[model samples]
Each structure stands twice: as structure tokens, then as C-alpha cells.
Target: MKNKTYVLVIIALITLSFSSMAQRVDRTNFKAGVHAGVPFGDISDLANFEIGLDLGYHWALSELIDAGLSTGFMNVFVNNDTVDFGSFVLEGDFPNIQYLPVAAALRIYPTYDFKLGADVGYAVGVNQGNSGGLYIRPMVGVNVGRSTEVNISYVKISDDYDFSMAALGILFLF
Candidate 1:
């Protein structure tokens, strides 16, 4: 599809740019990751789970800090059947929520295998009648190997209403 082609082209361009930056930065690396989470808050009754991918370029700013740009896709599946709580009942049949997250990434390493970071940016809506909103995720990670890291993060995407969750993710560095 034309839309897929456009996204491929953009990703290729960004990868090319990061490759050039890597030539001058000894600590730079490319990372790709996957995440999944359960919907909570006001949306808990309306949605199920979400899954996504994270791709980024991270370069060391100092021995203990890393920073770069990050973008990813996330999809929140809508609950199509009516949801019943002990106190009341609500209906479903709503459209799924999806977004493209574009944000700045940063990490602080306190030890060789431990890090803390957050991504702050905007989520571009990918479905009809959705305009998206501000996105923020704070995360903590532990290295599993030289090239793999596992992390836990809390995600918030808010506008008039909020689509929030607690997620677990993993990243592979190259």
C-alpha cells in the first residue's frame, strides 16, 4: 500500500541519518523493542490489552546518560461486548484506539545493568475520529545480556480523556 511505502521510506531515511551519527559517536546504538500492556483507568471498562513496537537511536551523552529519538506504534483493542462491574454495567462496540508515538528518549544508568528513563512526546491518532494526544512513559530497565534489556513502564496518552496503562517491554540493542 502507498501508506506502508511512505512509512518504509521515512524509516529508511531516519536509519540512514542515525548511521551517519553513529560514525562519529562511539557509544551510539540502534534499538528495537516490543511491548504489551493492560488498559486501566477510565478506559479499563472500554478496552482490552495493547501491543506495540519501539524503535530508537540512542547515543551516550556521558558515561551514565543516553539520549535520542524514539517512535513507535501502539494499538489498544476495544471491548466489543458489554462490560459488567459489580456496581453497574456499560456497553461497548467502540472503535479500537491506535497511535503513533514520537518522542525524545533518555536514560540514566546508575549501574552497568540498570537504567531509568522516560519518553515524552505526542501520539498521532491512527483511526477515524481520533486526534491523539500528549504521550509520556517512565521506565525502568535491567540488562539481560550484552544486547538485550527488559523494562517496565507506565504509559499515559491524554487529551480530553486518557488512554493509560502499565506495560512490560524489552529492547534489543545493536
Candidate 2:
């Protein structure tokens, strides 16, 4: 009976130690960045370029995966030369179109310094008569340091008018 009790206690101690070692620390982060976007396809005929800000909050789900929420503002400038009013050419630079994008973001880290990510969301137009639509962005990046990363991404928005852009950006994570 004494030998059996000692074995059971030793097993319990080993089980407890393994369970503790298997636990990982949870982490949360915030990231923000700015990007320059070049329009493509039919959008290139109307828009010259885009400038945007991105902000997000993410929580680590595992050693290699993160899930988050992201929101951002983007402005797409219209090409003045492309604007034709039939009777006369539109004179001034047209008002810049704006979008507010809200999305669910996911990222997977293949290496300590490399990651691939995607954001799926809706782009809401801030201007009257400007129809908002579905927004999708897929990106790849490398961490430059402990707190900064550089990324390149493609963004697509679909609505009454479909448009897409390619962007390069830098983000600070905290």
C-alpha cells in the first residue's frame, strides 16, 4: 500500500509539470500603418491613385496564428483628364472619393519574421451617392524589427463599380 501511494503521487507531480509547461502566454497587439495604392483595371480610367491609413487589434490564437479586427480610411483621387461631361471637359480636379473599410483579419506566421494575412470586410462610402461594397485584401510581409513590418498587398472592392489596387505599406505593432 505504501509503495502504491508513492507511485501515484509521483505520477500526479509529473502530470502537473507537463500541463504547466504546455501552456503558452497569451498576447494582444495593435497595429497601424499607411499605404499608397495604384488602381487597376476599369478603375484606372477614373482614379489616379489612393492613399490610406490602416489600424487594427489582434490577439494571438496560437504560436503561428492571429485573429483581429481592422478598420481604415482610404481616399481615391479622380483623374481630371478622364472626366468628360459631353458638352465640356470637367475643369477642376474632381472630389476625392473616400472609403471606410471594416474587416475581420487573420494572419499566419510561417517563420518568426515572415507572415501572410488576409482581411475580409465591407467598404462603406462616406460620400452621398457613392455606393459602398465588399472589401478584400491579401498581404505578405516581413518583420523589420521587434515592432515594425513592411508589407505588400492587393485590395479589391466590389459594388456598383468594381475596383482594385496594389499597395505597399509599413506597420508598427504594439
Candidate 3:
């Protein structure tokens, strides 16, 4: 866990330096945004929705390339109508587990308003015994206009579970 935070700090420093040095680099095109969405899978099938906030920062390296970081909360149901995790069945009555994920992303923008990105990072569950884990996220987004876009992402965490979700929200470009 300590190592994970250190790595995230290093990545943030590198990105910040690059941003500062690249004058004329449409940094405004780089953006920060918040997101919330329902995950699909056994959780959704069980009538459980994982809702959380996303703090995303994106830097447009070029017309076609970009990089960024995202950290957020994840709520997973323990038990419900579907299979159970241990004795818990992920359902509406189950509690949402909060996981803090920090990821570095590389994005390819085919159009000024559209992008596809691959994200690599780590996640730490706040609950005891939940174990922090490695994760990868593949995401796509479409810029709606003026710092707003809709995004969808596929996430694999800990090699134990896969999460797929779509978020409709705004990307605030600084």
C-alpha cells in the first residue's frame, strides 16, 4: 500500500513536469472531470448498482495522444440474488465496498471529440481484509462540448472480478 502511493506520486510529478514544459501544448485540452455510473455484471444482475465519484485528469499530448490519472471509489455488493462472495450474496441489501484506484492512462484520440485509452493502476479497498490489488482499465470517451464528455470503461481488478460500466458526465479542461 505504501509502495502504491509512492508510485502514484511519481507518475503525478512526471505528468506535471511535462505539462509545465510543454508551452503552447493546449493544456486546456487537458481536462479534469467527475463521473458516476452503474457497473454491469453479477452486481447489476443482482440489482446492485455501484455508484461513485471519479477524479480524472487528462493531458492531450497531441491530436492523437494523451495521458492522465484517475482515482475513485468503487462499491461492490457482497451478496444478493446472484452468487455470493464468501457467505455474502451481492444484492441491494449488501453493503458497497469502497476501493481507491489510482491509474495512469494513455489515450488515442481519433477525433477532437473522441478518445480511447488504456489505463494501468492499482486499487486499495478501504475495508479490512479486502486486500489492495492491481487493476487495468480500458476506456473510451466522447467530448460533448465545452468540458463535458461521456465515458465507458472496462475494469479488471485483482484477477478475481471484472467490472464494466458507462458514465455520462463532464470533463472539465483546465
| Model 2 spans with C-alpha error above 4 angstroms | 1-28, 84-93
Give the alpha carbon lDDT tens digit for every residue of 1-174 in model 3: 999999999999988777654752554544555656666664455434555566767676654677878777776644444455565754445445567888897888787688788778998777765576786778788877755777877666663455555545456665
lDDT of each: 0.87, 0.85, 0.67
TM-score per candidate: 0.79, 0.80, 0.66
Candidates ranked by lDDT, best first?
Answer: 1, 2, 3
Tell me how candidate 2 scores on lDDT.
0.85
Overlapping backbone residue pairs in candidate 1 total 0
lDDT of 3 at 61: 65
Clashes of each: 0, 0, 7
lDDT of 1: 0.87
Better of 1 and 3 by lDDT: 1
Which stretch of 10 consecutive residues in model 1 shows the poorest summed lDDT? 19-28
lDDT of 2 by residue, 1-174 (tens): 999999999999988765643441233389999999998866776787899999999877666778999999999988776455456555665677789999999999888699999999999988777788999999999999988989999999997766899999999987
Candidate 1: residue 9 Cα off by (Å): 49
Cα RMSDs of all predictions? 13.5, 5.7, 11.6
